[model samples]
Target chain A: MTRMIGAGRRAIAALLLLSLAACGAQPRSVPPPAFNSTDVMFLQMSLEYIRQGEQVLTTAQTRAKNAELKTLTAALQAQWAEEQGTMQRWLLGWSQPLTADPSSGAHEGHGDLHSLRPSDIAELQATKDNFDGTAEALLLGHLHNCVEVSRMESTGGQYPPAKALAEQMAATRQGQVQRLLKLQTGSTMGA
Target chain B: MRRRIALALLSIAAVVASMFVAIAPASAHGYISSPPSRQANCASGKVANCGDIVWEPQSVEAAKGSKLCNGGGSRFAVLNDASKGWPAASVGRTVTFNWVFTARHATATWEYFIGNTLLASFNDGGAQPGATKSHTVSMGSFTGRQTVLARWNVADTANAFYSCVDVTIS
Candidate 1:
């Protein structure tokens, strides 16, 4: 009977060992951070463009003559400000820097930077004539860039929450583009 | 009597240990849940006598190129059992399978198959996907009860996840 108890203890130890083996196979407890380069790049690019957009929206908010355009700018400022906060929080959680790396050349090249650029914001800031037209064009270009970054994130981003946000942003920006087109009467809004 | 008690105690300890192992974390895991795949049903208790897979429904992972529902993993081998007569969800010609992911991994391609015939495939071009993705697949002339095996090929890894949804198409 004593020997039988010894065998029982061995069986229990073996089971415990098996359980430990299974535990070893499990994903680590330190947290699984699965994010690709696209996820990081999208957040960085979006933050840069949205930061530039803040100034453009502020200009539109104060200087616009068109009533509907004023209302649109107000809406965009609030929405983008909230989205900016969200992206910043996510970037912090991912341990990514909020500022874009100028050395990466990701924001370089005419094709990549065509939609939103610092010069575009300056062009809007310095424009003395047709402020609304310049703002409209800049905002249109900014919106297009937002949609493009959103598409990139939705397709190539690994994080679920980030991808979900990207998809939502894409849909929202597309709708806003349509609205802006209706408000734009000049050739700049024709696209 | 003491021997019997010891044996019973050992069995109890084993059951408790197994239970603890079942709830461990699974990263980058996903499974199609709309039509209730074999593992989903097991997890939901809609089906019984299913081994191991009822614990981690999102972990039916194995190497790529397996035609089986569980991707040929022995841990989820019960999923490949055709004699279990898994329940089929009734759907239309254009059935959209909603893939509910616990964690979304970077993906290469999403493919669906009915037996030897390939139903449809979507190329992700080595991109990461969202938590819950949906694909609308046209069954075309195929009708009656069939098991649609969906495979997600991970871009970074050689492994892929498998989910077998039994659907009754009209």
Candidate 2:
């Protein structure tokens, strides 16, 4: 009995020491790595569409062609008006002209309303197309990431806005993938 | 043995709890770190610093000529951060007032007023060129929206210069 007690004590001491060692090791404390790269890609893609729309508006304004201007204006304006609501909610808690800065590098989620110059218009269009493609790619990528983020992880303690935004992006991007593909196809045929 | 188990579990729980608590505030939405530029003078042939003027009706509905604020006889406008009514209507209230005023003149003493009411008077003794002061009042005294007035009745008008007034009502 004495020998058994000594062995048990030794085992417990070893277990306790192991636990302490584990505790002492620095936790990797990883920041929830922001939404998967695809979410980021989609956001960037959305932002590009906004920029492209602006370029199209600027072109119409410069050309001063009434019919073309009206069509471009209506389409660009309609899309932007809808996006404004989304961006506002994403920026200010309630929307309505209030502007809040997203994190430093996370501005892929905001709108660009600053004035533009004629010289930069061409480059802006190119960027817009690039972004449009990227946004589509992100939509293609979202299904895999969404399952991992929503189903794999415990949502019990996730940040409300972050989680809500992820869900929104997931739904919106899927719809956008279909619409944007048609738009892209149409635009190519017209070109 | 049971006591030791409980203590060990308690320590582990405490560490995890503290770790989560420490990370939360950092993850909250970020805030604007700097204020917009402050206007130095309003009357230098410059259009009223479009950035400085703050009015609520924002549209045509700003209580139809409500007294926004008196800049002690200077020009004043609302600082975006200074607007009131959070978690409620931003421009729906019928009575809310706040003002920040700056003095452009040096003087021994000066009095500020808003329609028969004394807001703040200062005796600068030897105060500098641009003395600034702020006063706030609840609009419970006034009934309907009226053209609220503010003035800087200076002890020495020669030395007194004014900025602008920014007032918010409702």
Candidate 3:
């Protein structure tokens, strides 16, 4: 009887260990979202231009007489058209679209920064100072997004095509940063 | 007789061991229905008119000034953080939201705000800066559609973060 009891204890211990081992074999936690940093950079750049255009458009709206804003609007319209084309090409070639659908809603585009229509700019930047502040915010968001995207890409395996695109995006964003910085500093200094 | 005596001893040992098994009373954690109210669902970017916010919470803080048991608004705002919608409150109930943080005093604090209200206020707590904290007052009365606001104040100094979720009262 004593021998039987000892065997039963061993059997229970083995079963418990087996259960624990099985539990350990379960999969780990889920991975983060699939979006990479390259997408973030592109999204940020697109948003910057949108916001810049919106700022100019808003200035046009608040002023009793600002004809230059109209010209600015026209220029932005062309720029956005070009940008959309670029994004579409990338989307076509890259298996998926990086840009959000503008018609989806105000929150559709990257992080709730919606497309600024010609009409929206006038109302959005009615006050030059307010427009400037908003512009600054949008630019900051753009820069932050770029840095974030690059960080993600570094972690993602380096693919030549994706890396090249990231480089180009970084260059373009850098240029934008220069231009926006000048605009903001110029305005701040009252130059 | 010897075997009977051993069996009684074993039973007593088992009873004593069971008594030492520390059974603690279960704590009551508040629960909102698995899927929260949709009338003020802010995920879609479309504001729902009043008469939509409804949720069943198994347990909620009944403290006054709590923001957990409240919902209504012309524009309901739901923030999807990590893809989960922090459901809006409807038919206001008293709830107190508490956040605790520790920090040094007179230091530049970094903070984030969602709507117009100050959700977090940080103070340089001193050498051993204690926790910074804030809370929102959940309404006691539910009358009609009210504009729900999600506001945040990050750090020691910053503009309030603003977001809106509108819900209508029925």
Candidate 4:
């Protein structure tokens, strides 16, 4: 029995020593992280879309005939501006160029996900007196684009946080789309 | 004879339990790994004079909402020093930030900021993340050398993890 007790004591000491050494050892480095081209392109293009959509917001807020549309536009401005800032940081952190390389044929499989060009912005401004009509149409298209790019990111993004945000982005933009469609219906009836 | 055997067995069990207690880690949390935060740099031996943070990179945590790298706590306050000249990773306009956890904790949101402007935030919806997490952030129009403060806000607790990464965007 004495011998058995001695052996058990030795085993415990050895186990304790091993655990201590394991904790103290220089940590072996793990590979950084996994992020694919899709992750990169999605973020880049999303920023462009967000910036372009922002231009119409001030116009909508001041000029929309529909009260809900004007208030919703203001709310969207605050929310999307924050998102734009978030995407910008993600792009820089990944070490990719801030400006997206959409025209380079690199974003091949991703569907048409660009924001409204200057022409669209120009047209939006041209509808100055009746901004609600053009605002509804232009923003509806932008929100659809938001959902598209967000969908692409959700499906192809390997970065879990980015994917999680993409999912939330899709859901929010879809909700916004429904709201805009309702406002458009009401505006058309009033007109 | 039986009582002697019982006492010996009890002594052995007591010794083993004490060993296990000694081995158990205290407050194993997490810190940023990529673009290597200040604490991470200290742990990796990339920077010197890091104090206790060199051993416990994951414990640079304190209550939420402090702009300081150490969350305004005294234990890891060396991270708040601006003169350390920590090596800044040369990155483009966009970069992906990654993190490694010593022990996963329920997370609320991961936020990044430059100066007073919030660069980004990734919401976790009160979920326990894996051992690692990655966030792709755009620097936007921000250029030149900048120190970005990254934070991990815990879901259930009032505390959050803090890290600062210096970067020169070329």
| Order of quality (TM-score) | 4, 1, 3, 2
Q: DockQ of each candidate's interface versus the true one?
A: 0.01, 0.01, 0.01, 0.01
lDDT of 3 at A97: 32
Cα lDDT listed for each candidate = 0.70, 0.32, 0.35, 0.70
Off by over 4 Å in 3: A1-83, A94-110, A113-123, A128-137, A150-159, B1-170
Error of 2 at A169 (Å): 5.1
Docking class of 1: incorrect
**Across residues B14-39, which tens digit of lDDT does each residue of candidate 3 receive?**
33322221111011111111012232
Q: How many clashes (backbone N, Cα, C below 3 Å) per candidate? A: 0, 12, 53, 23
Regions of candidate 4 where Cα sits further than 4 Å from its true position: A1-191, B1-24
Residue B155 CA displacement from its true place in model 4, Å: 0.6
Give fnat, all candidates.
0.00, 0.00, 0.00, 0.00
What does candidate 2's lDDT look like per residue over A1-191, in tens digits?
Answer: 99999999999999999988776563437432322222222333344345534554554444432343245345545655675456445433311112112332222211221112232345334443333322222222222222222221224323355456546544443343234333322332232
Whole-structure CA lDDT of model 2? 0.32
lDDT, candidate 1, at B9: 59
Least accurate stretch of 10 residues (summed lDDT) in model 2 chain A?
A: A108-117
User: Residues A1-191, candidate 1, lDDT per residue (tens digit)?
Assistant: 99999999999999999988877765658655566656766777778778767888987888887788898888888888888899899878755667644443334532232234555557667777667765764665466556666777887778888899999888777566545544543322221
Q: Is the docking of candidate 4 incorrect, acceptable, medium or high quality?
A: incorrect
